[model samples]
Structure formats: C-alpha cells, structure tokens
Target: MTSQQHQRAAGKRAFITGAAGGLGSATARMLARQGAKVFLTDIDGDAVATVAADINRQAGEKVAWSAPQDVRDEANWERLLAEAALAMGGLSVLVNNAGIGSLGAIGAIELNEWRRVMGVNVESVMLGCKHAMAYLRDAQPASIVNISSLAAFKVDPDYTAYNTSKAAVAALTKSVAVECARQKIDVRCNSIHPAFIRTGIVKPFFDKLGEEEATRKLVRGIPMHRMGDPDDVAYAVLYLASDESRYVTAAELVIDGGARAV
Candidate 1:
C-alpha cells in the first residue's frame, strides 16, 4: 500500500451505524478501500448484510461485517461494539451516521414525533459515544465521527425537530472532544455537517416538489449550485477516521457545497 493509504486508517477497525445505504454505506466502502476493517450496522439486517458482502467482494477480502442495530437502544450499542471489537480484534473508529429527517413544523409536530427524532438523531450519538469510548480509548489514537446536518447551523421552520436534534449532536461532539482531551486520551471526537447530500433522505422533497423544481430550489440555495454526492461526505469521514486527523478534534467539518456560507 502507498504511504498515504497506510496513514489513512490501515488496519484500523471501525464501527459505523446506519450502514444500509446512502452516506453510511458510501463511507463504509471508502474506508474499506482505504484498508480499514469496518463493522456495518443498520436497523435493516438484510440490507446491511448485503452492503458488507459487497464491500468484501470489492476489496477481495473479509474487510467488513454487518449486524442489525437500532441506534436508539443502549443495549444494542453495547452488544454491537463488543461483537465488532471481537470480530475486528480492536476498535479505532466510531461513526454515528444513523438518523432520520423531519418535515414537521415545530408547532405542528406531535410530542411522539419530536421525541422519535431526538431519540434517533440526538440520543443515539450519546449512546454510541458512551458505549464505544472504552474500546476506542483502549485502541488509542482513535476517532469518533458523528454525522450532524447543516441544519444544525442553518434553520428552517419545516425542520424544527431535525434541526434541533442535529444541533444537539454538534454540541455533544464538542463536549466529548473536550473531555477526551482533558483526560489525555488519544481519542478524537468530531462532527460532520452536510447539506442536501443526494441521499434517500432528500427523496421526500423531490417527491413533494417535482424533481426539476426541487433540484432547482436546493441548488439555488447552495452557492455551488448543486447537491452533494454521498461520496463527498464519505471522503470527509475517511479523513476524520484516519490518523491524519489526530490533532483535529472538537471540529465541525461542513460539506454543504457553500450553502452555509450564505
């Protein structure tokens, strides 16, 4: 392998949540291609299994594993981390990428709906960090990448719940980073904020407003005049997951195609 590839998570074991498709699966493929052993987990067992199988096939090695996981469940986090560490021999990277989008206005959003969004988007980050800390600490020079959304900084009335939940993730990521640093742990925690990545999460928008109009509206908002690809976010994840970012923690990397700048 090239020196750059070696520096980019070679032999590192990573556990990623929401690995069935989109950004999660894209990140998994990127990491495996860069020589990382990844544990891909999602609520959909069969889908995640297929993702893992595909990654292994592409890499021509057993570079990935898959398991059914509900990120909101604390016990599930514990079990998956244990099993992943055992399977990969150690844990070095944790990617909190599982989340759901919201379209309800704050006043119109039901209590249960709000709680559901917070549970999956906000609380799951906490659960994963809480359970994975020990393993990551043990594996020293570890990294935790939480996938927040640009909605954390930017806001919309229609995304009240999602925006609030992602903002919490950004805050939690900073807190974890500070604590880890104070403890002299070689673990780094960071969050990635991507806006309008062309993932399944944005399909609802296209469905509601025809594809052309939806794309135009989204592109108009972004200074770059285009939506982001899943691989764009995946490349960012790979950097954070790799040792190349050892000194980078408590950072919020935004991949929003300049939308946040405006």
Candidate 2:
C-alpha cells in the first residue's frame, strides 16, 4: 500500500484554475500530497505542465494533471471541466483562483482594462460555479473554493476594479451556496479572502525592488507587519475543500495577516 492509499480526501478530485504558480500551485501540491487527484489549469500551458510534472515526480505517482485554459471562455469551461472530471473520476472540488489586478483608480482606469480585470476576476468564477455545479452535484458533499481578496471589504483607493471584482466573488459564492442548498445538491460553496500574500500578484514587486524593499513596502500597511505565505491560504483552501468543513457554506475565510483588524 502506498501513502496515497491513506486517503484524507476520501476520493476527492479537484479542478483548480490558475494553477501554474503561486496559491493555485501551492494548493494543488498540498491537495495531491493529502491524497487528492488534482487537475490544474492555467493560461500558460508550459508552466502548468511543469507544475503537473513536478507534482507527479515528487509523489511517485500520477496524482496531478494539467491543461491550458482561458477562464473567461464559457465553451472551454464546459469542455475542460468534463475532461477533468473524466480524468480524475469525478470533480468534487473546484477552486476558482484565476484573477488579475487593475492598473489605475476609477478616474484613471481605462474601460478596457476594467473589463479585462472583471472578465478574469469576476466572470470566471461565475462560469466555474455554473459549469461545475452538475459534476459537484453528482459528487455529493462537494466544495467550490473561490479565491477572493481582503480588498473586497478593505477600501483601496487605487484599486477600485480589483476591490469590486473580489466583492462580486464573495457575493457570488453566497448565491451559489444558497442555490445548491435549496436544490438539495449537497455541494458547499465558499470564498477565501487573503491580504498581501507573498505569492499571488505581489511576487512582481519582489522581482522589481528586491525582497527587502518589497517586503517592507507591502507590510507597512498590515498590523502584523508581515505578508502571508502561500501555504497560509493553501491551508485554508484545504480545509474548505474537504469534509472537515461540511457544515460551512457561503463562509468567507480571511487569511489576512491582521490587516483587516487594523
């Protein structure tokens, strides 16, 4: 018997978006290690393939898979999700983690940029929820983990588009959760709101200014004076994706480094 046979997920099959790197990659690795089959997708085909290969190599088994995806496309969502479910047996968990930031404030932002941000951050979640509902319904007591942000509740003047998109994700999670409950589908939906994590979109800052300056600039606003690790949010995602959170639906789990408290 292998370690995968120990089975914490109890035959959980997860489909994760934006899994080429950062939180998505971390969550995928954690889930695979904890005995779940993970289907990873990202727009960057090469990167996601590498991620899947590394996971399989480390596990000594084919526990992870990957594909290229543009989350904004409805047609591709239908096709890829079905493929993922077939590949992994069934789709019990869906993580809507693909998102991007806005360039400027409300007054300065271009409409095209706003639309682009909304398409990736907000519309993509809606598509995932709608398309994955049937598969999750079949795999009773399943979960949909949407990656929102603290910006949804915390006001940031320069990031109006990003904030609004995250807020929509939070609201969308609640709507899907209630609908599933009412329909007696046994599928739970929730959102995770993280603040200034080391990975995600903030890694670019580290590349530009180097670690020290980047860390200092980002942590100055947080009460904890530190950024969160990818694993911090990954652990939250693992909890939400498993049966341990059976009774938890439409909940917003904040993995902020005390930033919201201040």
Which structure among the candidates has the greatest TM-score?
1
TM match of model 1 to true structure: 0.97
- Report the number of the highest-lDDT candidate: 1
TM agreement with the true structure for every prediction: 0.97, 0.96
Per-residue CA lDDT of candidate 1, range 1-262, in tens?
2355354779789999999999999999999888899999999999999999999888787889999999999998999899999999999999999999877997799999999999999999999999999999999999999999999999998989999999999999999999999999999999999999898987987999988999998888899999999999999999999888989999999998899899
Quote the lDDT for 206 in model 1: 96
lDDT per model, in order?
A: 0.93, 0.92
The true-versus-predicted C-alpha distance at residue 31 of model 2, in Å, is: 0.3
lDDT of 2 by residue, 8-72 (tens): 66579999999999999999988888888999999999999999999999888888899999999
Q: After superposition, how far is residue 109 of candidate 2 from its true place, in Å?
A: 0.6
